[model samples]
Target: MMKSSATHYGSIAQFFHWCTAILVLVAFMYGPGGPEHRVYSPVHEFDRRLHETLGLSVCALTFVRLLWRTIYTRPEVPPASRLMVAMATAVQWMLYLLLLALPMTAVIGAWLEGHSVTLVAGWEIPPLFATSHDVGGAIASIHKWLGDAIMWLAGLHAFAALFHHVILKDEVLITMLPSWLTMGRARTGR
Candidate 1:
């Protein structure tokens, strides 16, 4: 039940996939302060806290998902070119790496600035380093750049999914989608 099938993802895979996807989207939105990025500019303490919390959650979930991927045989992505399959695998690994590194960079940046990431009601996660404004600023810059890069990469990933559905006319997207949602597509072989 927890493992995936050759034709589609199982419930467990779907759960982690959708949960992480939603959280990642939320973290991205809050990470840059969304529409307020221009008007608000610098991230405020509250937003920073929320972003860190969400990022940490994403990191944890992604780790579990990676472990799951290893324990279970991956569902085949139908038939695709070798090059395309290789590229898809590479992109997936990159996303996993980014999901882990982004939070770590944020944590280091916070620590260097002499701060611990906290959630509502004072659930605090301490930093791994001591205060050093210079080091913090340098790390923060890398964090900012990497976060932006991930966002762009994520967009490309979304576009690719759409391409699979619209252009490729394959089950690539449906396999990851909920069974109920894809029922009609399956019956009609769409």
Candidate 2:
């Protein structure tokens, strides 16, 4: 089914989830890390443009996913400790927040630095804000930190899901797995 059932997220939700994850990972890999000069250098142009494009895509997808959540009912997770539930919620929100903030910071920082956001096909989005090198540099620094933070947090998120599947022996992970990946197992979960 395309729509989510009480037992599991729909195909659409799973698609959004996995696609966002892949994009985030790829963008992170393409990120031109190091000093601003090195990052903005012609040597890294393609990588930077691809990274920014992927970041923008992630931002757009995340917004749509949030909107989808409002209209679609999510699967009901199995019972867990209140603390565990709260932790899960916190991590989820943090991931969403990073998904939005990373791109925003990248664009704003580039704009502040008097640079345009370059995309594929040589498309460019010019900076809207007045140049403020110092402030922009600071924001860029934060963006780098956030980039690192997301990787670590995503690692934690995956670890938690695996814990639920292996240690807890629950349906938490299976509920989100694609049907093909589930190998025709009962939808009711293992």
Candidates in order, TM-scores: namely 0.88, 0.97
lDDT of 1 by residue, 1-190 (tens): 4678998888888998889878888887777432323312344656666777899899999999989888887678778999978988888788888888888887787678666777645588777756897787677777777788888887888888899889998878887888889878769855
Best by TM-score: 2
CA lDDT of each prediction against the hidden true structure: 0.78, 0.94
Q: How much does each candidate deviate from the true structure in C-alpha RMSD? A: 3.3, 1.6
Per-residue lDDT for 1-190 in model 2, tens only? 7889998889999999999999999999999999889999999999999999999999999999999999999999689999999999999999999999999999999999999999977899999979999999999999999999999999999999999989998889988998788876667445
